[model samples]
Target chain A: MKHPPLLQAKNLKYSFNETGTSTHVLNDVSIELFPGEITSIVGPSGCGKSTLLYLLGLLDRPDSGEISLNEKDVLKCDDKKRTILRNHKLGFVFQFHFLIKELSVLDNVALPMRKAGKSKTASYEKARDVLGKLGLLDKSNRFPHKLSGGEQQRVAIARAIINSPSLILADEPTGNLDTENSKKVHSVLSKLAIEENISVLIVTHNLELAQSCDRVIKMRDGRIIE
Target chain B: MAMSLIGIVLGIAFFVITQAQTSGFEAFFIRTILGTNGAIKISDRFQDMDGTVSKVSKDGNFQFFFRSREEAQYTEGIRFPDEIRNALASYQDITGISEVLEGTAELAGSSRSFPVIFQGIRYHDHSQVSELNNQLIAGAIVDFAKDPMSILVGNRIAERLMLKIGDRIVMKGGTGTLQLRIAGVFETGVSQIDKKRIYIHLSTARQFKGERFAGSFFQLALDNPDKAPELAAQIQYHLGHRSVSWQEREKVWLDVFKALRISSAITVSSILLLSGLGIFNVFAIMVIEKTRDIAILRSMGFSRFDASAVFLWQGLIILFLGVLLGSFFGFLSTYFISEIPLRIRGIFSTDSFVVNWDVFHYLWAISLASVFVVIATWVPARRAGKIQPAKIIRETL
Candidate 1:
């Protein structure tokens, strides 16, 4: 028997209004992400790939669409409920790492669990375990600025997965890294998807990275082309 | 942030110091007045007599008539002085009660003569209510009492007349003139009292004024001066005599103090308001600078309320620290200012600055500053919470 999709979106639409001018960013886009599968959305600039990722992450509301996570409709959820869902059920990785510069690597990873009402000791213990798996246990006490590009991206990954979400969304996760760092981040993400049985979605312009995913969906002019 | 905190500290400190100074001045003036006149003075001066018009028209018709006005007779003094004193002495609240005879007299020195207001009192009974014994600069109350023919003169009166403790002076009253010896010289610090007043024995005043004149008034001191007005009212109601509290006697000065209080409040509020504005501006800038952090926090599942509480707590922490430091420095400043010696001799006299160390001033400073601080913090905190994560994320990323 086939497993059900972990996240589903149908006929999603979005737009941006700038000084009385409205531009449609996404048009009738739909996709299904299955558990333990790594999927990539590849498109050019202004092609709505990031917009789709944000929509799936529930960071922004689609103008018209149906979004369901684990067979439950999320469109009807209030802001507080949506935040809980984001903290517990979904994780996000951005291109810039976006780690708080003031916090140590361990504290950065522990933040999500802390927000989810976990005790500080439990959160830190879990954060240490994740860091040890990522080979960053020794660097956990150092601030984000002290880490290399690839290490910072890995810390961002650790933070993303700290709450053990069912799906992970990455928007150009390795866009700012060199060839070696990019490969390292790519391998870590693939390992996370298979080892944790969580859905992983990546939006990237790097064709090689897209080709490495289990499946790739190409987009043009706000609609899927493949 | 430092500047804003300093502003809060200075604002609260200034408020505290101003309150202490104002309260200090009021307390000093009240103590002087109470020491001289006691807390409550009972006399017939304020009593209302029956009208001179004894008859009115019976019918409600237009009538024109002329009637000769009769000479109005007034009560000479408090009626039944001993009864009033004895009745007041039984009250637990009344600490001391003394009868006083006040009249104008002429003091003729060997080389000079001056008009003076003389107060006559039984020394033993008067000492319980008045601070006259403590105020004597020369001779003692016991010595003054030992000689009934001797009188205690004010410092200014003795100085002007070039008299000493053994100098003999002639006192001319309404009825006759008598020769008297100067027993002591006292300084009450009040310029008017020291310059134009003298103390004579109550029996001598009666003899000097003749048998027709009773004592001028009875003065009573209470355990709590603040309750004088209420007790004065009660006494007047039961005894059929008019009673005036020290506060009522100094109504004009008290009114001036009230105005001072209002102006001080306005001034302190303005300072605090300016400080609050400084805090508001600092927080506003902070919100702008931490835009990216806010976006990240929101994206990390921090609710808007949590986001706002971050800034609100920051503002409140600053307020807390500022108030604590400000109160400490305010108390220190008032103490140092009060220690500075000053010689101000006038209607109101003091040798040093009077600083009131009431805890309420500190509490008032905190309460007033908190109002402005909370309002100042809430605006920017709310603004920080309202920042949209999607918009900020899009712009920054």
Candidate 2:
């Protein structure tokens, strides 16, 4: 049986003000996200791919739109409710690793669980379990800076899934990696969709990364063209 | 972090040391004041036409006459000694009560002569209320009690009169002159006391003044000196004697000591402010530099309040450690300084630098530093919280 879309955006619009001049960033964009699938938004720079991802991730509010997560109409929620949604239901991975330099790899992974009000022991145990699955159990105690670029990216992925969110959003997550590390990160994201039944939405410029995803939504001039 | 920690440590140390030094001075000053008079004094001069204490005086002391302000009118001392003594004895906090007669007289030795304030009290009762017995640098305070003609001269008075123990001096009073032997020499660490005060027997003092052999003021010792004001109020209500505490009688030194206190307070406040500004600047820069980190946390489901709380907790932890370190070093320095024999000779009558090593001072220092840290970290923490996760993620990508 086919499942309904896990996330849906309808007629989403967003604009930016630069030096008193208004510029349209995302113009009347619509998209749907499905469970147990990997999706990619491929577009040139400044084409609103990241803007769409941000709006879907609940990091930014669209100027005018309807965003529904599990058909709950998230756009109507307050800031605190949106934050709670992000904390418990959605995970985000940025282009850069952006791990807290002060925390250890394990602590960084467990941060989300802790923020979700998990106990310290439970958070660390789950953090270790996830790190081990990512082949990073040994590096769990190491600081972020002590890890290699690929290792840090893997750690970031571990942090994203620690809270077991329903959807994981990525904005060029593998942009800073080498070809080999890029493939490793892509393999991890693909495995998460297949093995964990997690729905993922990635914004990227890599054609290979887009083609490997279950669905590809191409964008140009702030609108999804294909 | 290191810079902010250093700033906090230094600022806290300065505050703690200032408190120790100021408190030391105030304690020594109070001790000197209370050494001559006890915590509370009830003068007999406020007796009315019916030979009774009518009311409390405006100055917190007994007033004999409410006549012209310009004219010098002497108030008769406490008339009802038995009744007042019985009233004082009823209170549990009243440790000791001594009847004293205080008047001005001149001491003439073979070589020199000087004016002095003579205080006569019964040795048993006076010794219980005053530290005179412990302050004798030469001879014995008990010898003065044994011999009615014996007197205890202050260190400075002894120097000026070129007198010593066993030497006789002619004391010229208002009505007559009498020869009295110096039984003891005391140094009270108060210039005024050492230079101008002479202790003798009440009977001898009365003989020199002629009739009405009544004590001037009843000095009261308390179990707890801090409770003097409350005890004095109770004493006034019950005994009908105008009670004066040490704080009331030593009003002259209040301004000088108050200036010291205010300067110390300002010094502490300024140091905290300057150090806080330094820390605030440091944290402000850290927040700006770590804007990306803040964004990462926010995007990972942390709220604005959580974002700021991280930095706020960091600052508080640093401040706590800094305050602990500062208190340790500050206490050592104050201890060392207190050991140095300041010998502020002939002024305030202290031998060594007095430093208050009270635990409350340390706690106060830490508490003050923590308050400043909270204030200093507030703006930067809030700024950190306001960082837009989407903006950072978008810009970085």
Best by DockQ: 2
Which candidate gets the maximum lDDT versus the true structure?
A: 1
Off by over 4 Å in 2: A17-24, A43-45, A76-89, A97-165, A173-192, A206-213, B44-95, B211-215, B223-243
RMSD of each: 6.2, 4.9
Give the distance in Å from residue A112's predicted Cα in candidate 2 to where it truly belongs.
5.0
Cα lDDT tens digits for candidate 2, A1-226: 8888899999999999889998998999999999889999998999999999999999999999899999899999988899899989898887888898999999999999999999999999999999999999999999999999999999999999998888999889889999899999999999998888899999898999899999999999999999
Which tens-of-lDDT digit does each residue in B30-114 have in candidate 1? 8878888899998763333222222234587422222232433446687577788788877789998989888888999999899
What lDDT does the true structure give each of the candidates? 0.87, 0.85
lDDT of 2 by residue, B1-397 (tens): 6776877787778777888888888878888778767999987443332332234467787533222223333355777777888878889998999988888889999977899999887999998898988789999876888999999998999988888899989999678899999999998877888999999898888777664435478998989988887677567545555677787677777677778877887777677777788888888998989888888888888899998997799888888888888988898889888888877754367668888778887787788788889988999999988999899867776
Spell out the clash pairs found in candidate 2: B44-B77, B44-B78, B45-B76, B189-B349
Write down the TM-score of model 2's second chain: 0.88
Query: Against the true two-chain complex, what DockQ does each candidate achieve?
Result: 0.57, 0.73
Clashes of each: 0, 4
Q: CA shift at A30, candidate 1, in angstroms?
A: 4.2
